[model samples]
Target: MHEKKYLILYSTQEGQTYKIAQYMAQELGESHCNLINLHEAHTVDFGLYHTLIIGASIRYGRFNKKLYRFIDRHLAQLNAADAYFYSVNLTARKEGKDTPEGSVYIQTFLKKSPWKPKKIGVFAGALLYPRYSWFDRMMIQLIMRMTKGETDTSKEVEYTNWEKVTQFTKSIEKSL
Candidate 1:
């Protein structure tokens, strides 16, 4: 295969999506990859990249509105290339919910999105009490309580599976 150029664009609310994108870039070798915040990356020409990976975190039953707008704007370019999309949500932390089919948020987004990526991933997200604002912290705590999750405000839990992340990257690499 010829040398490939990749773009890893992410929209992060609490930073998990950005961290995932960073790791993907590292695994892909930074030399041929560019990492950009989706909100600020609208001006970049997507046609120039041979591979595109978009990562976004879901909150309040929705993927970031900014990311939706970006996808809408670049639907054709994204569909034209080898595009992959990953969604980070705490719901994926539960057993049997890590895959795209099992993730309700992923399913919802897929139904709503105009651009369907060739690859889809669903990863667990983080709960950083300190990082959240007062209202967010309270709301999240309530959610955790309702969901029978960790509600200790002082604790930080990251449910992401690093091994799964590695596997996903390898799958992308195989295609390239």
Candidate 2:
């Protein structure tokens, strides 16, 4: 029997999504998983992997356009493989918004995309104030204020739930 090969692809703005992908790769064993940035990958042979996982972050209420393009180009391969998707967004920091049904971005992606993932996860993203430009910081602060989130831009805050992530990873392992 051949060892299962996994491909983990991510599209991130502030790198939280990629960080999550890296964590999953580490948990799944580096040798068994291949991590690729959707923006950087010029070509992807999706058929080479037994499982495919995509992690994408929302920026200004949208996933990257490249993500949709990749899905459109490889719709057949995605549907053929044991594929999963996870969306990362600041809105997920809220109590009820940390789920697939509660995540507007995930729901929108599922509705717009031709390929439906076999499983889905929703994770909260980080807020890195220092990494952002002055304009971005202000915009994010405003959004945070409106949502009753952490509005202090002096420090970086991570909202991801590692326990949930571990659970998601275990679920993936169990499915195989």
lDDT of each: 0.89, 0.91
RMSD of each: 1.2, 0.9
TM-scores for all candidates? 0.96, 0.97
Q: Tens digit of lDDT per residue, candidate 2, span 54-162?
A: 9999999999999999998888888988999999998998877889898888888879999899999999999999899999999999999998888888989999998
Error of 1 at 108 (Å): 0.8
Tell me the deviation in Å of residue 163 in model 1. 0.5
lDDT of 1 by residue, 145-168 (tens): 988899999999999998889899
Q: What TM-score does candidate 1 get on C-alpha atoms?
A: 0.96
Query: Any idea what lDDT model 1 has?
Result: 0.89
